[model samples]
Target: MSAQHPRPGITHDNRFFWEGLAQHKLLIQRCTSCHRLQHPPAPMCPGCHCFEMEAIEASGRGTVHSFVVAHHPPIPPFEYPNVIVLVELEEGTRLVSRLVGTPPDEVAIGMAVAVEFEQVADDFVLHRFRSAASR
Candidate 1:
């Protein structure tokens, strides 16, 4: 089946990330200068201001730093009463996503999470965070 919702924000930096998701991989930008990894990929490293960078696949492991339960309605294509979260990856980068496989009230700081992708369109997929099934 194809994705249900598609919001393509294609750019030079993030194009790889989105493309990687379509293949079930999580890609992040790594700075060649300081060796720091960054999400929301950029051409320049915020750490050393270096233009040298490369794309690397991540382990897709992270922890929930913060989150909110969407009691109110969400934007189009998103159902209400969902959990959106700011996840801190083990690589030290934080990404925003929806939480799955857990109750809203059960979400807490430092809760272990893994990557989950939903194909919301034919050519696009969204990355969401979810607690491990063993939890």
Candidate 2:
């Protein structure tokens, strides 16, 4: 881990999500009652206010619903003009992650994407999006 690279602070509600990434599997929280799938794990479902959630392995497949090309304020561990995307999973949940394996200019709304993990620290992993057709 780079000394300047900040790490994610995990908590009970989101621990499973982080743990699942270590195994190279993308996990999202599913509401046991409403069946609503959500990301950034939470204790209660916003749709139905259900207090129970289950960790479900995502297909790691999604489509870019929105995105931005960030070029300012260069930061460590990230390239300038990064393609940040909002991926809408096939399961109907959405997550914001960096887009890779495709040029920043080529990134478009509705582009197909899939999950890929990058280990930023010994115990931390960042889930990023890549062009599904790249591999």
Candidate 3:
């Protein structure tokens, strides 16, 4: 039902991030050898190409570094005029997710945001953002 909520393509490299979301936690991969943070979960660290990595729990807080108001090319399971944001996490990694609980015009660069999870299906959850000022 509801297109099965589109499960993520999990792999050995990124399983930790997905499992962490199932536990309602946000995790980023840190190169245990080089001490740099990475998102989208690369198998090798870009800094030193180390295959070793560790999970770090993110603060679940970030600032709006950039955003775009998507008004065209509607897709199923999502509303049009979506407010998409590129958030720079407190840990310094940037991620793109939909921004909620704030108007598109109200969103601005440097605005603080906090992570929130929404269950799109019984077995899947998605990360979204809301203004921290709304917290």
Indicate which candidate wins on lDDT: 3
Clash number for candidate 2: 0
- Please give the CA lDDT of all the candidate structures: 0.84, 0.88, 0.89
Per-model TM values vs. the true structure: 0.89, 0.92, 0.94
- Ranked by TM-score from best down, the candidates are 3, 2, 1
Q: Candidate 3, which ten residues in sequence have the lowest lDDT sum?
A: 1-10
Clashing pairs in model 2? none
What residue runs in model 1 are displaced by over 4 Å at the alpha carbon?
A: 1-6, 133-135
RMSD per model, one decimal: 2.5, 1.5, 1.3
65-105: candidate 2 lDDT, tens digit per residue: 99999998878767877999999999889999899878888
Which clashing pairs does model 1 show?
3-119, 3-120, 3-121, 4-120, 5-120
Q: Give lDDT tens digits, candidate 1, residues 5-65.
A: 7466789878888889999888888998889988888889998999998888888899999
Worst 10 residues of 2 by lDDT: 1-10
> Which is the better candidate, 1 or 3, if ranked by TM-score?
3
- Tell me the spans in candidate 3 whose CA falls farther than 4 Å from its real position: 1-4
Total residue pair clashes for candidate 1: 5
Between candidates 1 and 2, the TM-score winner? 2
lDDT tens per residue, model 3, 10-113: 89998998888888898999999989998889999999999999999998999999999998787667776799999999998988899998888899999999
